[model samples]
Target: MNELTPDVFDALIGQDFVVTNDDGAKITMSLTAVSRFETGAPATDIDGNPLRAVGFQLTLRGPAQPLLATQAYPVDIPGIGVHHLLMSAFEAGRTAVNYDIVFA
Candidate 1:
């Protein structure tokens, strides 16, 4: 399957997705921010070598239900297709939480 690029994923903002938690609870998450604040610096390796790295930052906001998870999981978006990614929480509130989805 062709995976989505950061630009394509960013265009999918305001979309909703579903994921099953470890406890078997299905939750709904809305795509809030396609990416977090980025400086646009060229990605490089530890040795400062330029690398052709492409990544998407998906911010999922869901209800106060059990957290979606901070690990690799599969999420399905209506027309985008299913993607297995590592979703990590960066900031959260009483109602919703921000997740940084690793689109590798």
Candidate 2:
């Protein structure tokens, strides 16, 4: 699998990703937004070299029904391989629920 970066997902906004529920059912979620930021602190590599602290967040919208519990789920991103991403439901409306995946 390729490294997941903000740029990698930036172009994928508005695309649908399939999440396999615990019951073996597929739930479709649309990639609503991608937020990117930089941490104030500098990061260091394994070799102790300084690196920039960058991170990103992905917001996905799915149906309100079958509200998924906060946990890691297998999400299939088209063109990209399937990845187990930690998702948390942050908002809900009458018809849709929003999930967030943060990478830092």
Compare the candidates by TM-score and give the number of the best one: 2
- What lDDT tens digits, residue by residue, belong to model 2 across residues 74-102? 99997997999999999999999999998
lDDT of 1 by residue, 25-87 (tens): 677888887653444557876899754455456788877657665787778876776777788
lDDT of each: 0.71, 0.91
In candidate 1, how many Å is residue 2 off? 5.2
Q: Which portions of model 2 miss their true places by more than 4 Å?
A: 45-52
